[model samples]
Target: MPDSGLEGLLRELSPQVLGALVRRYGHFDLAEDATQEALLAAAAQWPGEGLPDNPRAWLITVASRRLTDLLRAEQARRRREDTVVQWTLPEEHLAPAADRLAADSDDTLILLFLCCHPSLSPASQIALTLRAVGGLTTAEIARAFLVPESTMTRRISRAKTGIKTSGVPFGMPPEADRAARLDAVLHVLYLIFNEGYASTSGPDLVRSELSAEAIRLARIVHRLLPDDSEVTGLLALMLLTDARRPARTAPDGTPVPMSEQDRSRWNSEYIAEGVALLSEALPHGPTGQFQIQAAIAALHDEAPRAEETDWPQIEALYELLLRLSDNPVVSLNHAVAVGMARGAREGLAALEKLDDRISGDHRFHAARAHLLEMAGEGAEAVESYVEAARRATGLPHQRYLHGRAARLRES
Candidate 1:
């Protein structure tokens, strides 16, 4: 429990500590290196000394000292006289009098924005933010991206280098540039929520810590820019989806399809909250892809049972979503809903149209298998399920598909 508490403390303070370091060092790479040194010091010192009452303050103090030492060593190696003068400014300006780092709300948001600088690619931005802000391990991020751990480590290292070299400002962008950065911010939040809601590769089905952090960040963004409908939509969408998390997996940790999930387990409070937020967001009249997705989740939450789900309404939402963003995944999901609402044949036709688009997706095969089974094509369904199982990455999901295929064989 003490170790867990220490881990949590490090997670919560990492962004603030890193931000202060970056502000002082004027380089993301230096800040990250210094933060790591601070964490190492904490690991060595905390257990024997007992956890500090003010862990963040202790971390900040330790990190500041480490940075000073690093600067002094660099100055000595370079034999530069200006190093002393340069060190004085940061030493004088960086430390707080009370040993506590005062993190104003704006400062935190600025940290988030800085992590999403336009200089980096979208993948790099997500990786860097997960590392520096979300406090995720490189291994976890590697799993999320379906890449090798070494690849992810290199990606993060390069991202920090790019930020340092690009001369991106540490503060928030101007109002003129805010709109451009909004997409990057939204993408980061989306990745954060997805990682939480369905961790790519982990023993646990849900990572509530990541989800909670994403929500906190979203709420901060909403407060900072109240009239932004997309931000409101994202918050509403996350709330609606997270509301179903209680029923998303069985107690034994197996995946539960939405249709078979016990609706009684759903959190009415979160659903109601999400619905109200979506309603308020609608009047803003600036509907985006997220708003449409939230509406679909809202419709499902409002239903009493799987059969009660408004498939027609969901189909409409999907159509709108496709128009807003032509993602093959959205089309695949829409095909399933259409099959449920209409007949399997109609759904099969829609699914067929998406064959080329979703050829690489395992869910595409899984959905097609279900539609085929419903249409009395058992052999085809079995083949599709076998393909799905072959492509599926997660153990539980692969097992589910294999089981489905075996059942067809038995029949």
Candidate 2:
């Protein structure tokens, strides 16, 4: 196999291999380390060795042996320090026999639940999920988040320690806690997607790798829980939103507003799939945030021209979303929708009500600037745009806001 193909195969199997070792031997941290070692071994040898017939089983066997070696080393270290080790060696099998039953059982989803254990913080959960289940190295994760490798390493370590101390099992949470656990899992995935779609602070507007990985993970969850409306909704939302990514930035890498983007560049297949998924999921639910957001995205996508967008329907959906959650960002979005659906003056009035909510945020200023320009208040719009640019952390956001202000000034 080629290098890229081999790498993809190894990443897909990393979590399964780690999960198998942890499930049988009961050492998550050690098993994780061993899994990384096993992956490294595979990457080094798989190309020249010309691919094993049973790659998953090969990984599990290698990881299991590495785990045993790690356990023995830890035991010896603890013995030298006159302290007892918490983990025991599996003396019977150096590496468990590569049986069909062991190889076939997938623990990736279980590993996700474990990585998102309730004892850990949200940051740790995201870090650990990307590290363990997503098969990303610590340095790669750190770079994606724009943090030092050491910082990410500590975060992952702390997360694993938290999981160990909590003594969570190697299976799904109990029936009573499953809902909450699933919610955590979904929320982590959402955060990851959002970060990838719009990085908090970076030169680039979109982190394609992070967004793509989030979508991949969401698809896995959707496949596992096909009947869950929220899962389907989340996947649809990601697909619909990401479909526009090709036109999200200019050739110069400047951020492009959705209204001004060339619709010809949008991914039609993704749009169709997303619409189908939303249609399939809505009837299964009383409605959720992801479904509403996906509905809004569908409206934008279905319109052949920007002016044809159903702003009123989008405004209505935003209203419904507000009823579900009182997020200030959602309020700002609702105000923008109102501006588009109604007149700019009416939108300004709606935005005025949010002064006590998100007035200090850059998004609030950006929306105000846009509405002000629509209302023919060029002077005020310029100031708002400059303010928004000043408050914005991401380079792309700052550039766009400044460009908007400069254009209004020239006009």
TM-score of each: 0.82, 0.95
Q: What's the lDDT of the predicted structure labeled candidate 2?
A: 0.89
What is the C-alpha local distance difference test score of each model? 0.80, 0.89
**Model 1, 311-335: lDDT tens per residue?**
9989888988888887999999999
Cα lDDT of model 2 by residue, 1-411, tens digit: 878888888888888888787777777899888889889998988888878888888887888788889888998888889886555686655555422344433578888899888889999999999998999889999999999999999999999899888988787678899888998999999999999999879898899889999999999889878899999999999999999999999987778999999999999999999999999999996788889999999999999999999999999999999999999999999999999999999999999998566998899999999999999999999999999999999999999999999999999
**Using alpha carbons, what is the TM-score of model 2?**
0.95
Q: How accurate is candidate 1 locally (lDDT)?
A: 0.80
Q: Which sections of candidate 1 miss by over 4 Å?
A: 1-13, 33-65, 80-105, 137-152, 199-209, 250-253
The model with the greatest lDDT is 2
Number of the top candidate by TM-score? 2
Alpha carbon lDDT at 388, candidate 1: 92
Q: Positional deviation of 139 in candidate 2, in angstroms?
A: 1.2
